[model samples]
Target: MPPSRTSAAAQSANFSTISVTFLGTASAQPSSTRNHSSLALCFGGRGDTWLFDCGEATQQRVQKSDVKMGKIRKIFITHTHGDHIFGIAPLLAGCLNGAGGMIDGMVDSRMEPADPKELTTLEIYGPLGTRAFIRSALRLTHTRLDGRYVVHELRFPRDPPGGDYTTLPPHRCELPGKNLLQTPMDDVQWGKGIWNDVYADDLVTVSAAPIEHSVACVGYVVNEQPVPQKMDPSHYLPHIKRNKAPIAYLSRLQRGENITLDDGTELLGVPKRAGRKLVILGDTYDPSPIMPLAVGADLLIHEATNAYLPGIDPATNNDDTEEVVQARTTSRGHSTPQMAGRFARLIGARQLVLNHFSARYRGDDDVNEEAKTVMDAIKGLAEKEFCGEVVCARDFMTLHVSR
Candidate 1:
């Protein structure tokens, strides 16, 4: 269990500050108001930006938002669909080419220009065909990245056999791209389903699991390390004032470290708080396979491409029943608001955020006479099933995940 908290980041507060920005929310086709599918999750005090799916016009969206392109360190691709990955090559190309072949000229998450010699390599993770798709696009377009990028390919039982131009085991050796790595995701060494430790840093960890979609798709679960509980000054301040003890004792206590004052005052360390977890999935008809990874997530970002609530929707079509609408959406390997809500309930998520909306239902920048009614119906459907907070995500919306 997480300890109670408030607004305070003591010196020991190296806690992950996870902020999620919906860069693009449109589904297969982008409307004038909404772009394609893309999400930016910024973590840590440095504001390291990690992207989930990069569609066409994503560069434009990033330029218009607060997300710094140079701060992008890792990109996690869901699948090889054009709409989900078209912007990768272009975005990476800009990062490498814009700085005269030196990425260090780019600003970091801290908004400070990195040292000229600090050339941290970029990483990209995705399903099987991701390597081929990106390699082909970059190679054919003659877009050479003077900097380094490693592509980590994931393998599933459903994936086809590996070969030339295929990202498979025993990868063909090539001149390492500027001493960068190119390899496959580690095998499923222990688990029956989940791919544990997909990616990890000092601040957080990411795990991957397969989701049911038309093509091979994977969902990611981000889990932050438990943060030290906030120190209750009332518990010690009065005592300190009475005793004239050193202030450094409080600092150590905040980090869950036991401390003893000069006069022999003993203070027990505060217990750590449970960290926040986020489960983000691509377009999917079902995602039961990720139950273990997603269950009890703090936030679940699921695709709700369509929704039809008989009494709430602004639909005039007499034949468009909830069943009909759901069938249509599921046929395309997508989910309705209620489906997303049901999954959220099954996973025991605390809150639900719905994205990857179809162009017809609009909000934020894209609004029509029926937009509010349609979007409300979508949220209503999800709330009806999940019994939790349901947000219909719009482009450029920012959400901070708190412990």
Candidate 2:
């Protein structure tokens, strides 16, 4: 078990290893065991985190767990639905206001003020207009945050030089303006490559692809780089036998170097082993577009709200007595348990973690069983196709992605 309280960097070693905590997993409404819908994906070594969604109770979840809210450098809002992003305003405030803010006042969390010169801006990435929504909410609430923040709109037809161009099948270069003038464009290209990232000394890359959903919802693929495997001390045994200076040189050698000493002595070409890879998807009903991108991900965190109620029609069936909920789920655009599992198996994730549940299912027992049922169902179906580990995620749960 991971320590209850620990620094983000201290939580794990490799960037290939990820700590994913589900704050809320319910659809639309809040439940005792599950809140709305939110997840924190902590990429180890990188010290950078990505939030899949921010539900209303997300702040409470962060306060109760070891996750550092201030460390959440990036957030991706899947859609504008209330359940997905209702908690963002408060979450941002909790980090910005330090000890006097929402969570600070509630949980007594502290912030060791950093020098102004060293502060890095918090980046919020989401669908088009998400920034506007957050700005409006902050303005209306009269909430003030101390840190610097910038919102980048993940809009369609991304800025030129990052968009698509078609070519003729005859291997001829088709000019952008003339090709579409006479013919209908059948193939539409999506995605603006993987997002290049650098957080402190850590590096990460993100890619986005359009998924089938009711509205304009896209799924994100997070590829985290793990810390380089620990250097074998035995490799530098001779250096330790020499002197302290040689040992210091070994440290540099482990950092991928061909070391040359002041006296012309050299330890040439010491190559460290490569690190692990972790892949995560925000939310997707269809698994096709994201498969290649998610290929060979050591760990894959996908939505599980739909995983429990396998084959149970969300349209005609809901445990809630209210009839509106049954119709709301599909109309509002959310996946079911079986749907989530199917996608995971299709994508070929080495391990599948399911999160984001419906409010109708409450209590740890019921949710766990529901999740088990879905995983079992998927396992039964996938036995002939694919074999991988599947898990039902709970709040504050940590797993070793690279272990």
Candidate 3:
């Protein structure tokens, strides 16, 4: 559990900051040092928690961390890959059976029946077939998540000639000029629109764009709404002390409204701080289409599955040739470290966090020497190629994001 909040911490916790906890970071397969892909995004301090790509045993990982499973309000699945979504069933089951207490004969319950009002509704967004997947899992496992969770299946607009693109409500950004929609040949329904606005609320808005992958996949960008300006209490304290102004005036001033003093002088409210933006990509070989959405993002979390570091020769290490590595990664729809760097640079991300490493990069010992070496190479290449802070993500690592 996290430490009790101090007065200062409590003051700062009012949605002024966002933090991301890496629950898992391995790719395709789990390693001794890493699990599959899972990320927990906490916004506005403890306001809301969102999970991206809950891989197998992700709930167990959450149990091992300081994150509160009951606080997870949303889950975004990049795709239906086992490595990315196998944990959804168990996690949903756990959410429905909060505190692990028996609920009307349901096993895995530990506490009293959870109050419906206190239970956070879990909204899951994912690519096509996601609804069926969740339903089938619940049925097979006999897990009852009836009103506890909702699944949203996203589909691309059909091809342009065959179908037209229509603008959706709550536009977040300018549409990408280039044609990013996949064609019929891709084996899935193609959409005319380059991006889709999946979720939105007063606090944050989320959008998704298709990316090049072996199967239908999409990347998500989350942008927080600009915060309201903070009121400068010092400026009004003098007036309150001198004239005993009504305390109600303080509420008006905090809402960015001008307050009229007894002397007819007007006082303006201070503007609140700006919000932050974050982008997280699914398993993809090409990230070009999503660059528009990722532009000016404060943080970009992308996969670095292949070890084809630039300026390094794979043959010297007695491993597979560079050409072989590149071909395999490309064919498998995975990105090399250099590719991740290039995308971060192209999108002008402020910070780049590389994860989703292939299991082969797992170190011989617990020290993770091989992974560190690869991470160093990636950081070096990205420093030269991009002008952003580069970081290698590890399981259970937490990143604090602020403006």
Candidate 4:
């Protein structure tokens, strides 16, 4: 016999899923094999999607993938670096045109005009100068987004506030008749002062912290919110019906509130399901500031722009011995593979995904031999350092996050 409706609902509620797609994984510049840095996060239950770091041709990458451009509600820019943010304006323009059915002046004859209420406003969050950068880009391109793009500029605390870092008040662009953008600054306190809650909703909470890099850059952590457990109706429906429980009582029970039936019997609600945590880092030399956020994360997506020399043992080598390589990456404001792995190990991340490879490692002419060697070495180091699964990120790669 088919399962009852309540039983199915209960089973469905037992799991929560999130997926991350690597749209671009190259560093600084696009290579024959990879684009720049971009990724998409999709929530399975709500069908909500977010973009992180829209690099050059990110829209094209999205087009080639299964992601729907119209469904992207938020874009998070890690910094003002061109490779990290150059694609924002074009992507926005494309999204606007696509949603309004103005693609190449070819409109669907039977389609009605898009409802203003149905229009999706894209919220962009980034560091200081984000608004100016976006504004300048739009103005120079003569692209009028019709106030559909809302920008949120995050501010970091002046100096270290004793413990960690903190964010100053964020500047938000207001829309007509409604404020669609909300930040997690209010929800998260100035703990250790290193990280600030940037975005939070019923489904997830996102936090950001500055990392050590050439310019001002930030990394983000996404945490899924605990959902109320589903109660099997078959287990309680008969008792509830026999007791003639009111609709209000049933609603309260579903909400995990204790409810007393007319027969003076009490029903306990099911516990909530545990949520998952994901961390995505920008270009950084030192990831220590956000180490707390990375701790216990289910997935940690970090940049591995450089790799160790083939014969050098990272554990045995001293900083002085590797000064040249260190200077190269640090001067360019990037991280080495060993750095990424060490960070993941320190945090005890369950899974580590390394991306943003430097162009020097690209071996397009030789069928990616040099690149594969670098990636293999990085994976080897990471495997030795971290106890979890390690993966080298490639463009269009997707991973499912489930709990």
Candidate 5:
């Protein structure tokens, strides 16, 4: 059976800054230290959540973390690999159950004042095949959910191999006896791209763009929602406090408004420019074209699947006839920590976070240190390439991408 997938959503709140939480970081499979690749974006003081790449064990991961599935309103799946997907069905099922159950449990047993029935809805976006996959999974499980959500997927005529596109020499072709001299028709064909306007808020918007990978993949960008020009806060603060509703006052502050009370009290501290931006990349070796999409982002989360490991013979390459297929594994769309850092610097990312580590060096001993050594090396590759901070990720680690 094909694995399940869950996508990510974007949100904002008058109460807090927007943030994303990494739920899993392993790829293709789960390791003791990592699950698969998944992230949750929390927005809206309303607690709306967006999920990205729900791999297996995602439900458990969210359970262990502060992520509340009931808050997840959307999901974004990058690609359909077992380790990258597999968690969707169970999570959706669980979320649906939890939504109704939370209300039932609250009314019957707890003394909470708020009703749970008004919880947020959930939607999932992915490549073209997502709808079919989700339909099948839900059908097979004989389950129906009360909460409404949609899965968007990218479609391709043929399944592509894994990894990003590269300009391999004809001699390096995976095909036997094929040289670069061959006609363009002989070259591999890639899937077209897809762009979806997934989320919008009073002050920010989020969209997805198709990216090069073994198959059709996507990169996402979250930009601050467009807002009215800065208001003279000198005009708005005093009356807001007189309203006696801090939440209302804060909402007006975010919307860039100055309030006038009967006494003409003024508000201060409204944002001068737009909000911050963030870009999260999936597993692609050469994500060059998409760099501009990530430009000026406050934080960029890119995959660095290999870190500090000498070469390994994945033994999966068809080009083993060449004496050095071991070196070629890294060449085939897999990224090392150094490469992740190099790309981050190249894109002028404000912050570079390395994740999606290969299983080789994920051992208990010095995994974090080993990953850092490789990323730090990228600094030497491109002196002054990135002025941003570089971070090596750990499971359940959270970081705030501020404006």
Candidate 6:
């Protein structure tokens, strides 16, 4: 049997921490220190891993990091940028073939789940061209999978994938290569600039909104569902003793199941406690459109594509200023550290983790490199705008967000 997935009731009081690990944090291309843009959001409570972008050589990064590829259940792509998505086909092929120690990864079971129509499918969510990109890559490369994949594309009225009309939104019927599911984001599925409830399960509800980027880019907001409240055993203990109730009742109650005692006294489960919300944006100059869902986020992971470190940045000169850096970064549809911080402050995020650093900035693996100093200075820039805990993300760095 598959490893038992923790239910919301079972994980109620566990309130375990969720870990966000940066697999690659480089912008545009790979440097010696950074790969590209990709991160792993691992939920300890659920035993599931979700990847937010799959840049080139991401599988290599996964091999090096503590993250287990076997647990990756879903992947969310920000846009159709090559650097943000080049690793997808290889990762999927590996999972389906169970090669390279990925034996337990989400695989093809052939057997249907509890639901009769259930297909052991890997789900991928992204922008308009995602289905075309994946299908073409998998098809052109002659890469086959034992299992199937479901691609959900957020369609924009103004933006559609150029040169790929066959795989465009309002998806065609499933092709037999292995039954790919392409579901289009319809009018009912969207608002002015937001795609509400892009995905949701027992643990979390994910939403997406358009951000200002050169391409049709969107950002995601993951709001964890409230867990059942901590059990107040004292209240039930008295009644249990008085009624000589079975000890098993306590366990059931802790699981948030209402129990009727021998005396016919009914005990209601404790109220649920609110969970945390996390906002993670893609390459963007401005992300104000998603403010409604992102306000008061517990954690915000924003891109910091360029910085104005005079002594460190290769582009920075004596006459260079943050304003100059901001203009250049925004012109390319990317954010600087200060821009990220300002957005974090607008959302009232408690913690800010900045990612997608330029190639000039080094990564954390080399302690002797300028990464330590450059990252600290970058974090300071964001901290100036957002009065929260600011962090400069490095490849393989993990941040734990407590429930």
Q: Please, what is the whole-model Cα lDDT of each candidate in the order they appear?
A: 0.76, 0.56, 0.71, 0.71, 0.60, 0.77
Per-residue lDDT over 1-403 for candidate 2, one digit per residue giving the tens place of the 0 to 100 score:
1001124543444454566777776666787776777778776555666687888878888888878877887777776678788888888877666222223223221322346445445666666556656766665554545665565545554333322222211101111111001111233442333332212223445655555555545566665444354677776656545544556766666655676555455665455453444555555555455555666666766654443233642433445532344244445455554455556666666776766655555536434776455445533433333467766665666666564
Best by lDDT: 6
- Candidate 2 structure lDDT: 0.56
Rank ordering of all candidates by lDDT, starting from the highest: 6, 1, 4, 3, 5, 2
Off by over 4 Å in 6: 1-15, 98-120, 159-164, 167-191, 243-268
- 2 against 5, candidate with superior lDDT: 5
Full-model lDDT, candidate 1: 0.76
TM-score of 3: 0.76
Q: What does candidate 1's lDDT look like per residue over 35-111, in tens digits?
A: 88999999767567899999998888899999998889788999888889998878877655422221233433322
Q: How many pairs collide in each candidate, listed in order?
A: 0, 8, 10, 6, 32, 0
Top candidate, metric TM-score? 6
Between candidates 5 and 6, the one scoring higher on lDDT is 6
**Model 6: per-residue lDDT, tens digit, 1-403?**
1111234655434437788999999999899889988999988856778999999989889989998877787888999899999998888776555223222234334322456344335678888777778876765554545555677777675654343435433211123221112233344433455677777656777888888899988899988887677677888899999998887788777757898887899988776777889988999998987787799898999999999998766668788787987998899999999999998988889999999988888886348556687888898899899888988888889999976
Error of 1 at 162 (Å): 5.4
Model 4: how far residue 17 lies from native, Å: 2.9
Query: Residue 274 error for model 1, in Å?
Result: 0.7
Which digits, one per residue and each the tens of the lDDT, describe model 3 over residues 1-403?
A: 1011113333332466689999999898898778888999987645678999999989999999978887887898898899999998888877666222223344432222366454445777777656657766665444444235666555665323422133221111111112223223332243223444566655667877778899888899998766666566888878866767887778767756777777777777656665788999999999777766788899999887876554443433455666776678889999877778888888888999988887765522226566567667656755666778998788888999867
Q: What is the Cα-based lDDT of residue 85 in candidate 3?
A: 94
Backbone clash tally (model 1)? 0
Task: Count clashing pairs, candidate 6.
Answer: 0
Weakest 10 consecutive residues of candidate 2 by summed lDDT: 171-180
TM-score of 4: 0.78
